[model samples]
Target: MTSTVAAIFVGFKQLGIADETDQRAIYSRVTGKPRLSLMKPPEKDAVLAELRRLGFTTVPRRANGRQQLTGRAAKKVQALWIAGWNLGVFDSRDDAALIAFVKRQTGLDHASWLHQAGDTIAVVEALKAWITREAGVDWSPTGKRDAAYLGRYGYKIAWAQWRILHPGADRIARKGFDTFVVATTGTTGMWTEISDAEWQKVMNALGPQVRAARKAKP
Candidate 1:
């Protein structure tokens, strides 16, 4: 009955971080706040105290009023938190089963599945790109961004934009993701780079779209 936010975060491993980061980023985007943490319960409590000390709570009341939770007091957010257990609720010791549950729960057909399990919509939109092979207008010489670079959502988002603005998928692959990832191997056109700024922009802009998409799901 007692645990640290860090422990939960460890339990969540990587996917939890992505989900919470996306949620907090989306909240900041809509409200124009500076930034927020995606920390778990105990850590969140400490962070909440820090915010209180910083006097961020004194500003004009937001839609949800509690800036600490980032308007996430909705039943849906709470439900999302609870739904995470579908992956690990019963089998806590089995890490493989836990990870498997995570995949089953997220159901996002990602290239690498690097992110924490997120809202159902976020997962779906991510899958929409990873699972669907499409054509787009030429942006890169290849016509589509590399799957390895975009992870699940990033590749899909970039490709989707190309399909909308451009029409070919080949050009995207050539120009879109050549240097997107950072390469330890240092091969020609093998890695892609994702800058924090670009990710923040994408999270801010595409997040709402993904969230809306999740809301649209069954």
Candidate 2:
């Protein structure tokens, strides 16, 4: 396919307008052919025009180098990263690990903050797809409750630490600990009902206790 047509396809994919079936239908509507490879230049141009009419626009390249991600894209990237962390796909909380993962996915060596809009979108889409395929989790701009908990307190890791520190604790002891946490953090409601800010507060209140538990003898 021509470069213009390829770019049009990428734009449609990014806009979430055309999947494989929809793309074939679009091609048939525009050029009387369902196969892109069969299209001549004129047919390709018609398809491109149709795509533009449907809100597909070419993204301009940065003159100096790759431009930083825009505000919306940056937020999406952050949310996906947090989702990955909660899903255990990303084990490290370091920003460097996120940058490395983005680079591997996008084949762009630049830091995530320096990625062009297209590269940023590609990374975000890939991350979303990977998360969905592996964990069956939908990627949202504001992450889910588990993501909030993990982002705030390293939830799984914290719990693992707690278990190691209190390996002999009984069910009643566990319940007592949970009660203490809830009362100390002023956290109410079920896990799903808690907001992200509330999770942060819960983690903040529990962090010191966990630390003190770690420092105490078994």
Candidate 3:
């Protein structure tokens, strides 16, 4: 097979789309070709673009010519680690447990650094979904509770203001605040489920810091 044809196959495999019938369906949709071997240059380009649109990141080759995960895929790996930590599935210091979790989830017996971009993305998404279902909190790419978990009120007012004051804060900061909310409110419930008074307590506790940060920004 030509390099382009090989790339197309690799792209599909990375997408975790292994069924020949399904692969042919996508191939037909992109190139109007019934078979990958029949694809022209333009068709190949189109199919590759479609794969990228579907969240496929081309794994970069190392100096030794081995394929390595991309930076974006690495972040997903980090997020998975944090999610595992937060869920109490493993302690923060347990690298072996994280590798084991990935092994169980993806059936891949290597560390994330050795994973292909597609494998990393697939595993991260699957793990995040599992964490959300188990913990009753939507997980973000940053490995913290998603802003949506705070619901309309908490997100719109409290989080909005927090972001305004701490515009440069990283995901770790956001995670810390999320941790505080869970601890203070004593539940992972959404804004509607939690009392207005409880929300007020969060605001009261953090409001001064927000104001001080705003003042200090200049």
Candidate 4:
């Protein structure tokens, strides 16, 4: 697999594009997000134009839309994808509204949002800040703490189940403590869904820590 492709996958946030025909194929098509490096030339121009409109200069970035991505811009784009996908940033089902939401979100240079939506290394740091500064220490699931029980930080678990989802995979999020439910027929377990062993194999590589973590849970 190419790095760019890997980047796209790594960057994909599961948001359905306005024209998306197959909702299930997000994982397969978004490999490492090599496509992350790619901008619709128009999209790139618009982004640059926006930055300039906001008074930032268009000094040549290591990665420009017309050219192969490079340096900070490439990394930043990759980070955006990672954050977007990790956050499960679903906009309203309306395509136009969702697109507009995304533009407004990152455009403001939103610190907290960016921290949540960025790459692994960056997200961790942002998460630390988010927990400490914004949330003021993690709280119990019920918003109260008891002596015997410990609570899980939700944002920490935000991406926990993500690996189980694959390209073109149909995942239905369950209620609290809900592992994503999967089935073929767009729902209804009677038909049942087929899970690719290959995707499972990728998950297995998460190694002993993840394995033990799964084991430690019910």
How many residue pairs collide in each prediction? 30, 0, 0, 23
Clashes of 1: 30
Candidate 4 structure quality by residue, lDDT tens digits, 1-218: 53333322223222223333331233224332222235444333333333333343222223333322222333444333333333333212232332244445334332122222343344344434433442133333533443121232322223243332322322243332122222211233321132333223222333233334434546
lDDT (Cα atoms) of all candidates against the true structure: 0.36, 0.56, 0.57, 0.32
Clashing pairs in 2: none
- The alpha-carbon deviation from the true structure for residue 104 of candidate 3, after best TM-score superposition, in angstroms, is 1.7
TM-score of 1: 0.25
Please provide, for model 2 over 48-105, each residue's C-alpha lDDT reduced to its tens digit, 9 standing for 90 to 100.
7677667754433355543333322555576566655554446554445666777777
Q: Which of the numbered candidates is closest to the native, going by highest TM-score?
A: 2
Give RMSD (Å) of candidate 4 vs. truth.
Answer: 18.6
TM-score ranking from best candidate downward: 2, 3, 1, 4
> Cα deviation in Å at residue 148, candidate 3?
8.8
Off by over 4 Å in 1: 1-147, 150-152, 169-191, 195-197, 200-218
lDDT of 4: 0.32
Tell me how far the alpha carbon of residue 93 in candidate 3 is from the true structure, in angstroms, after superposition. 4.1
Query: Once model 2 is optimally superposed onto the true structure by TM-score, how far is the C-alpha of residue 65 displaced, in angstroms?
Result: 24
Q: Residue 59 in candidate 3 has what lDDT?
A: 61
TM-score, cand. 4 vs. native = 0.20
Misplaced by over 4 Å in model 2 are: 1-75, 109-115, 139-187, 190-193, 199-218
Instruction: At residue 15, give the lDDT of candidate 4.
Output: 26
